[model samples]
Target chain A: MEAPATNNQIPGELGIWLFVAGDLIVFSVFFILIALGQKENADIFVQSRGKLDLWVGVLNTLLLLTASWFVAIAVERCRTGLGATASRYFSLGILCGVGFVANKSLEWGSKITQGINPATNEFFMYFFVFTGIHLLHVLVGIGVLCLLRSVSRSPGLNERRIRTLESGATFWHLVDLLWVVLFALLYLL
Target chain B: MLPFFYMGVFAWSGTFCYRVSLGTWFAWVMLLIYYVVKAIDRVEQEETASAQGQRYALTSCAGLLRNLAHAFGWENELKEKNVDPLFRKSMVFCAWSGLIAIVLFIIGGVILGEMLPPLLRANDPPEEFVRKVNEHLLSIRIGSVFLMLSFALFGPFGAGIAALTRRAEKSPVFSYVQLVFTSCGTLVAVLVAFTWALMAFRPDVYHPTTVQMFADFAYFLAVFSVPVFGGWCVVIALPILLAEEGQECFPRWVGYVNLWAVLLFAPGQLVLFFKEGPFSWHGIVALWIPFVAFFLWILIMCLSMLKAVKADDQVTGP
Candidate 1:
């Protein structure tokens, strides 16, 4: 197999890139919407923000970042035809996703137990709704990575398959990136 | 009665108004009559199939009929051809027929239904609701006619989506699935619209409780029937998402749009839990968001279909 001739070659399918771009736009719009909501009710948002456990947000952020690193390495290994190492890396990446989900569930469970939900107030509404949507994205990203991991383990993985792996990795990274912003916006800010 | 006969004639003729040949009018009329009969039978046989189950079966049957439509569209083409050039062009035209339905629904549902009876936001008292229904009886009657016309267009819209989705497969399985989901969705739309019509038809005659019951029935079905259309989105999006690199029926962005639309539609389920606020049938979360998202979905699909049809036209130049 020949290496890609161009220095600036796109890593994945054009389709995935289009999807990622759309996802980013949607999240950006959500961020803006929440910011406006904060402006309207600063006191409630500030109080609600304080109620959140910042450590959980930080921990989830770190998990996603580490997951991104593992997936990046996995994509490189797949491109280099290192099937076993790539599979191992993908497994680690998936574990990180699981960790993030578990952390999120605990955080939400704590809030619900304290009688906080979307209908609690304007701040909690945005917190729950936006995070709920982001959590969905994270779940889907994990599913995509799982499929890529299995595909990576095949001995007959081809150039096209490597590109597909890279595409899936890009999406996983986007999920992480969005969570980082969400962590800061909802939890830190 | 004379006006209704005129509307029926208009609607019947409207079926043939698509770029479809006049020769097929007889067949289209027969199909319409068959569904009308089926819908009536389903209504009468209330004990047999749950409303949801009946809708599911009806949609599946609609899917089969869409396959038949595809067969007719591609009669002269190769057996393995997924999309006919003619079908691509005509399907867009058929899809635009939905605009007729949209206009009618807005007029009937938004303007008239909401005004006289206030059927959608059912927080009013029995006497108040009954009094309003009686007050503007004529407006409600006129609105129901437009609503009926609107629901009638789902047939063409389902057929159009099935035909368009054929671009993704050599076999007609996905297309058939699209058809079935869309067909059942149409039935739900018609039934809900009919409930509103039934409420308005004899507002003065029926007891207030009976009128309120019809309103509740219509709102619940209209708001909660998300899965019906969501299934249509899923089947259509799967093909586009999985289609080979350049062979995609529409751009990949359209598939993502479908995904987002499906997500937005998910909130409709909240209606069952919350009777007020954003989760209620009239609330922002359940009714408004999903409704807007649906129209946006329709608009984007229309644009994509038209673009595909134009590209096909260029490929098969006159």
Candidate 2:
């Protein structure tokens, strides 16, 4: 079947759109709940937000945003039949993902050592659960990117394989978008 | 005199309380209302359709009457219409498993388990444990019975999912594997419930250490054996994700939800080491969060099954 029409006619199978939309809705609900919780415990939420490492959040945000850009560029290169260059972009994207994971682990490990955890308060609970779920998405996205990278390196890349790669890249972009929202909600706000 | 009796018991064994939590009982009430309303709706729709059949003279009203008969528990009169018998049966099985068995599980797992939380924990005195078990003896037994029934019901529930999934498979290998994993998952859940029940059976009669052993059995079965169910999740998700576009049993999103459920369930494995944190059995991350995800998974699968049933009915109209 032909791909579904996306914004600017995005390159991906139509089914990935459904998956992306569904995932966004789930995350939206989580964000709404976190917002409601912050309302209930404004003092605790504010204090807890202060305890979060802003620099780490900023670094992770930058990493994911850069990864998203690289993925977008890789998709563009694929469209232009630049497979070798696209593989390089995909590798960069994967490297950024690794950085995000490593940085997130260090941040979590520091907080845990400080004895600040989800059980400390409602705010921290939301912090851990929301970011924890987002981290899972990021990890899955990294795997998808690896698969896309393998496809890029393959000699017999067809239209179907390209669409699959594009679909995986779209999902990586989604992971980045969710992290941006999470960073803002959990840290800046 | 009653006050003195309580005082004496407490003085001898300390204050050990075992009673269902208010939240659990509240959830059970909500589930009951949901199923009751659904059953009513089903009956009403069947009645309306039967009337319409009589009015149209397009088909005999007897078929519709048979549906009503089936709803009222007269299975013999409920002849299979043109719909695929497996799909129809699966729908019915899922409904009962969700509505009845799940309600039972809430009573057994959530309510009763909460009442005796220390029973599942590794650190607790034998006397204190027996005291607590005896305190809520009746509810624990009833809850155990319900949990066992729920576990038994999951067998067909899994088979129903397998049936729905088989539609997209060129070979039924994955479907059979799903069936097997779902049954094994059900068995593990049942074993967990059984251990809890066994502990409550004669708490005072058995040695306190043995009772603690039973608790260990329950917790280990409940917490550590989750990957079996996780395997089922993968089996369920892979088929739907890989199914031919229009031929998928449910939407692709359901497959992703299954994958998310698998992810959500992963934290339960942490119960092995962290006995007190969020990864603990009583903790939000390990127990409550996964339970909520599982509930949503069932809810989505329920809708998917109904969708399958409707599509089948249309394809094989009576």
Candidate 2 residue-wise lDDT, B1-318, digit = tens: 475455445544542433434334445445454464355345534544544543454334656776788889876433333346765766767755755555666666666654223344444566766776788788778878777886777777787788778766767878999988987988998887788789888888899988877876776676577679788988998888677534677665567667767766776775665556455665655665566666556655665677667766775663
Which candidate number maximizes lDDT? Answer: 1
- What is candidate 2's CA lDDT for residue B12? 49
- lDDT for position A166 in model 1: 81
- Per-residue CA lDDT of candidate 1, range B82-164, in tens? 34656765777776776556556666765665622234465677787688777867767787778778887878866776777
Candidate 2 Cα errors over 4 Å, as ranges: A1-58, A73-88, A101-136, A149-170, A177-189, B1-87, B110-128, B207-210
Model 1, chain B only, scores a TM-score of: 0.70
DockQ of every candidate? 0.16, 0.12
lDDT of 1 by residue, A1-189 (tens): 897576334567554665676567657767887888889899999988899998999899999999999999988887776887889999999999999999999999999999998888888877887788789889989999999999899888765577679878988999999988998889888
Whole-model lDDT per candidate: 0.74, 0.73
